[model samples]
Target chain A: MKLDSAGLQILSRHECVALLGSVPIGRIVFTDRALPAVQPVNFVLDAERLVIRTAVGSKLAAAAQDAIVAFEADEFDPGTRTGWSVTVVGSARAVREPEEIEYLAGLPLHAWAPGSRDHYIVVGTEHVTGRRLSSVDVG
Target chain B: MKLDSAGLQILSRHECVALLGSVPIGRIVFTDRALPAVQPVNFVLDAERLVIRTAVGSKLAAAAQDAIVAFEADEFDPGTRTGWSVTVVGSARAVREPEEIEYLAGLPLHAWAPGSRDHYIVVGTEHVTGRRLSSVDVG
Candidate 1:
């Protein structure tokens, strides 16, 4: 697979959606203590938004309250040197409605760590974008 | 730049250190309202600990007041089909001492975004780990 700078710059909406739909994990970016941070999380696509779960008294809960956040997911094929990444920027909020929480909880999401998984953070996207890199582009 | 599973595992550690040392950006993972949430942040490596700046109303400050947190960083290179990721898991705390805050402020770190930088969230890492992926492993 080959990619050009122009192609990388102009990602179609369909491509963005595809990337988001195909990948289940991504890095979420937000501000904590006035510093930039990113973390890997398994998310579900809910009504074109990203949803995740965590525990109370977690760092993520503290930093993302009504704040601007960025979520990203990508897949790269090492053999062919091809990969695409999609990022969604939006504000995050804690879901309050019982119905919404129950619906989100039914998703096939699991935390790799052990703790009381009792909190939820939803990133409501304002913008969606993506970029791709490939060996063909270099050639 | 080819790698086997074992090589990928070894590179994960190097990737972790590199991710932590290369920049002031990291991600905070925690639970938000019973769901998992992640946000990006700027951090400094202080005495092997990850330090960040936050404010009173900030999420990090609230989370770190008394809870376990996860901080992470990584760099992915699609060209060589190789990349590394690092994560630090530990407890976070607020730096109240004037001397410590002043010393941290002197570090060569800058916000990747624009905003009024305040407060500080420091994650004292009790564990650090990383991982890599390659075609061979996937195949």
Candidate 2:
């Protein structure tokens, strides 16, 4: 897929939503001690919000108290050197209502790691954007 | 890259370190308002430490003031349905010395987005691990 400047721009947005809808996993980015940190998380698209799961003592549970965060997901095709990335910038908050919890439970979000996996983390999108790079454009 | 139990275990560690070395950009996973949040960042590998750039009044600055964080990176091959992911769990700390800053400045990290990217966030790997998924395995 040869992406011209305009095509790259359009594909960035289209791919953003497409990747968001096709996958339930993303990277949660934030600052920890003046340094950048990222982690893989199982997420669900709740309306315009992205929701994830964590534990009580988990790092995610401690840092997201009234803070801004960045969430991202992407799909890359090495053969074609083509890929798209979508990033969501927003504040995170815990879901407390029983009804919402019940709704979230039905989603396919599961922790691939073993250990304590109990808490749920939700990132609300304040800014949503994406980008794409292709092999044809490289050479 | 079909993975048996043993292969999965070994691949996990390799994936984690490989991710740390492969990409210059990543997301920081933190907590805000009791929910999980993420942000994009430019980083460098300082030995086993993952260092990133940041600034004051940034969400990362607020999140890393004294909390645990999860850092991650990955490369996935959708055609073969195989990919590897690595995650680092650790505490975040600020880089205070001028010499350290100068050393970090010499690394190959660059920001993909335009913004105030001055502060440096460094997350040391207290624990590092990864996983690989493949459709075929020889052993």
Candidate 3:
């Protein structure tokens, strides 16, 4: 098992994808007005791609279009001080085609916020990296 | 109670800072190699600023220096579909003064990862905005 400099275990690409699929919510990082902006989102993994549904006119839908964005998901326990974080850095493109939107709508992706989320932003898994800190390795 | 377009409650600056102090962990968004990167970190709020302790030569310490960055912290309950998310967009600067570092060391901010974390990155809370979703507002 490869370990990072901080002694956390470096997760493999496959492990990263698996861990990402385990979580329903994630945070997306994009540039807004030339400054970095992060927003928590609900997403689903589809064949190594992260699909997020949001309002068509939301800031995320505008800023994330055809931009290099970062997506992160993790689960941590304060009492145990153990958790795993997976990050995917790639280009985010809004899905526009009718057939593709129909297929994506068939997925189990649902928005938690009360709104008409009609836009789909898909981020490829170009660079997938993850680190896990187990209870045994907690210092 | 101001409601965002998505029906989430818009939190005031006072409420945002209070919620930020409630969480010990947060995600920091910074630029790496001209691309956005997000990393989860252990941090503590000092008044209106966020203090992060990291290794001296880490990427976070390097990428966040004198740059605009985003810090996000939140708590969510999946079953109840309720949570609060606070985002702070501000400039990040490294704590170089020995006396200031010494003073920061006195804070209860302890690094979770096993390593010598002697570097402190302080992010100013310039534009703080937050949203809260309650169970009663669930759709």
TM-score against truth, every candidate: 0.52, 0.57, 0.96
lDDT of 1 by residue, B1-139 (tens): 5343234444454456666887545567664553344545657787778877654565556666646677777765434444556877777777778898788778755543333455666777667877654432111
Q: In candidate 1, how many Å is residue B73 off?
A: 5.2
Model 3 agreement with the true structure over B1-139: per-residue lDDT tens digits: 9999877899999999999999889999999988899999999998678999989889999999999899999998888778999999999999999999999998888777777888999999879999998834332
Candidate 2: residue B19 Cα off by (Å):
3.5
lDDT of model 3 at position A97: 100
Ranking by DockQ: 3, 2, 1
Per-residue lDDT over A1-139 for candidate 3, one digit per residue giving the tens place of the 0 to 100 score: 8888877889999999999999879999999898899999989999889999999889999999899999999998888788999999999999999999999999988788887888999999979999997734232
Model 3 lDDT, residue B58, Cα: 91
Q: Which should have the higher lDDT, number 1 or number 2? A: 2
Worst 10 residues of 2 chain B by lDDT: B1-10
For every prediction, compared with the true complex, DockQ reads 0.05, 0.14, 0.60
Winner by TM-score? 3
Quote the lDDT for B12 in model 3.
98
